[model samples]
Target: MRTSHPLWPAPFPILIPEPRGYDMVAKALTIAGSDSGGGAGIQADLKAFSAMGVYGASVVTAVTAQNTKAVTAIHPIPDDIVAAQIKTVLDDIQIDVVKIGMLGTPSLIAAVADALAGYAGPVVLDPVMVAKSGDTLLADSAIDALKSILFARATLLTPNLPEALKLVGEGSTQAQAKALLDLGVGAVLMKGGHADGEICTDLFVSRTGTQDFSALRVNTRNTHGTGCSYSSAIAAGLARGMALSDAVGHAHTWLHQAILHADELHVGQGHGPVHHFHALWK
Candidate 1:
């Protein structure tokens, strides 16, 4: 009763094969603020996406007049304009993934949520609260709305230590990030860049389980847009169909390298930005 066909390949393998080709170009859209500094927000997003070899698009929710030092001002775009930007992009392009960051107010949050609802692509949210220079970008009242509308619809949430604490309530930690996964979002990435230690660790949690990713904590003061870069990288990976954990892992790795590479190249007088193009010259 043994029947083995010569033309048939192996029946099955637990290991998955890597996808190949220009069938590989994935599209990622970022709905966030404009960082005048060119280190965070939509600026960092598009750079990260391009560095990762994926097409990047953006819809500006707000305009942040800032630099590596501080966010001088945040001007939220009109709700209609924000919605129109999203509509224009989505109508013509097939977005494979979405990365959301710093919506200045509750109204912008609602507008972004409504605009994104129809697109069932993977969504990554970076709950940007305070800027690296200690300036607050998002309004305090917008916190609840971000959680209710944007977080609920997200496929992944990238929250730094402080943002995680706020989202899951103050005094929250790695344990609280696990609790975040139970809140209905598909996954949560709790970044440990703000932690006081020799190693920088990022925690990725989901219904399946929790995974910790860490690297040698570089002692560089130029970490302006780390959160934005990380989330956009994750979105790019997701657009390429990488599993959630795999995407998080790749993002962490890429960000770690970026930090190390930016260890010397001075840009701004204050906190500088990671050299996103390091891979090019290396």
Candidate 2:
């Protein structure tokens, strides 16, 4: 009955019982595309996860030729390959949350939806439709596929003003959030970066209630991966057992410092990345 792995040395003389998962750091899986710039997509997701003290795993759905300037070209991974990556990771890793980013095409979206069929956990979906440098990332045709296949399964859908408009047309932030919730997502985070004002507000809307988190918006060109990192931070907090409102608040507070410190970094000439490790660096 003692069928431990040969490489394992069992803990003999166990005197005290340990709490379940006490030794394990929270783990999250980011199923997204690759950003050659390292500012967004899987790169940003991993960095954000680490910054939040969460272990990160990744399944890349596409590879993009990109930098701070623009996303030049995108090469989507085959649906089967994407599915395999999801299966391989989910079969082994004890992931606590699933953070999904830019999934290029409809086929890849379907594949991800299928791969995550039975997974019952928190899913934070950041609708990465456009890059920082005004390059389109998601296909217009795939929007329907994403909503039908993944929205219902998502615990949080973080969308900026423009992306929310595309999904729900022109409306107030609250109206947009309600429209997205009507699409069957569990909750919606209406990001206000695109809106005009010194005071930035992110509205969190769900069936139960709504909460608005406001922060001093830092003015910086180094906002390349803000959305990606924000969503990952939320996922990290959720994995650590925080409520959704608390997780959103945590991300909002952390991101201000990151953006405030970004000017210290000299990356590409274009829109650079946020300082995901700002807390440790400063």
Candidate 3:
């Protein structure tokens, strides 16, 4: 014989619910320069990460004075400050993925590499050499430093045709990608947007195998920040626990849609930026 409470049934066993835990948000860090026009670099990376539903953090290595048409000038931040920024963020927040872009100087590159030496998460390195307007964002002398300091540690290196060629010399996309992979990078996404073809073909080469992604090229003048956005999107996917191939596939689709809808916004007189918010508004 047992006494029952008001909420309990007689002769029934008590049922207790398990305690609930807080949901953790996916977070990504972008170590890059700042684009004043808000189309590329840290701005584009943060936007892309947010668009993919990932929390975004950034350490601005340099700041550019430019519009969509051209990069007028770039002022690189001090190496110590850059390193401090990286340290501050990593010490407080749990970074799930990292997207590196536009380290304008060798010192900045080394600083970033050293700061991230012990980070075990995936890193997406976009070898951003030139701006959309043909302005050189990276110094010619810093190429060797980048290769030595960061390439081998990168989980994925995303390079446009020109950047890939600069890394591996003249060769087919597959050859260039293979050459880059030989440098100890876990993978390489060789973008073919700068090549001559109606369809843009991007090759993803990793230790496992090679996968090709192609899309019908959309003829448009508003193609700024494409590289930065693509790499950031891939980082976001990786932060969400997606596989490398799946992340690249999702980034390819996102970039294609952004390019297709780029003309929707009018910001500058020269080449405008892609619609980073296309999925949300359009």
Candidate 4:
């Protein structure tokens, strides 16, 4: 028997808290190619996004039937379909950041630019021109289209040493970075992974000033998707509302860790992928 008090009834009833609404999750979109090998491109981008605790969406511009050894064949998605995919995602979801990679053709690049014309979210453009296996991913004709149509719209342009050289046409690293920054992109991250040096230095150039990030070169053949992982990690940081410089710094650290532990994973023959899940699983 329960005693009744001034603040209580004879029969006590248990009270439960009402369920709360779900919190809004940060979302990121990857406009890139599909790598069947699960190393680079959309797969790597999505993995990096997830590792950074962001929801990932993808719009595939092309599909490559390849492994760690080489890219055997590539089928570029139609421009209309690529545009439709981007539009559908944008129509329903509020994207926090967009990461672009591996537009195989000029039409596809133009289509991607047009689709993302009015998007206000931060965009990180990874001008992917060649595969790790030395396979041509983007045609020579598409380079001009990429610069003209998309450069102005990008919040950040991430190009490797080779791609930077191609964009600026034969110059020192600083000169190439300056030329790339002049293309109207808000910022440029010139990657030096391809350069032969004891320390790999990445240059982040903007209108304000330039920042240099250097790390010891991790000597390993398993560095296939370093570029993709770096750009997507930056996009992930941006989606989490980090400042541009902070985001780049975090991404640089993440990429270095991934590369440092790359040899742990055994995936395929030839140039394997960096361990994108190193932080999460380790």
Which ranges in model 3 have alpha carbons more than 4 Å from their true place?
1-22
The alpha-carbon lDDT assigned to residue 126 of candidate 4 equals: 97
Model 2 C-alpha lDDT per residue in residues 201-251, reported as the tens digit of each score: 788888888887776668789998999999998998898888887788777
Each candidate: what lDDT? Answer: 0.82, 0.86, 0.86, 0.86
Q: Candidate 3 has which clashing residue pairs, if any?
A: none
Residue pairs clashing in model 2 are none
Candidate 3: Cα lDDT at 101: 96
**TM values, all candidates:** 0.90, 0.92, 0.91, 0.91
Give the better candidate number (1 or 3) by lDDT.
3
Q: In what order do the candidates fall by TM-score, top score first?
A: 2, 3, 4, 1
- Model 1 gets an lDDT of 0.82
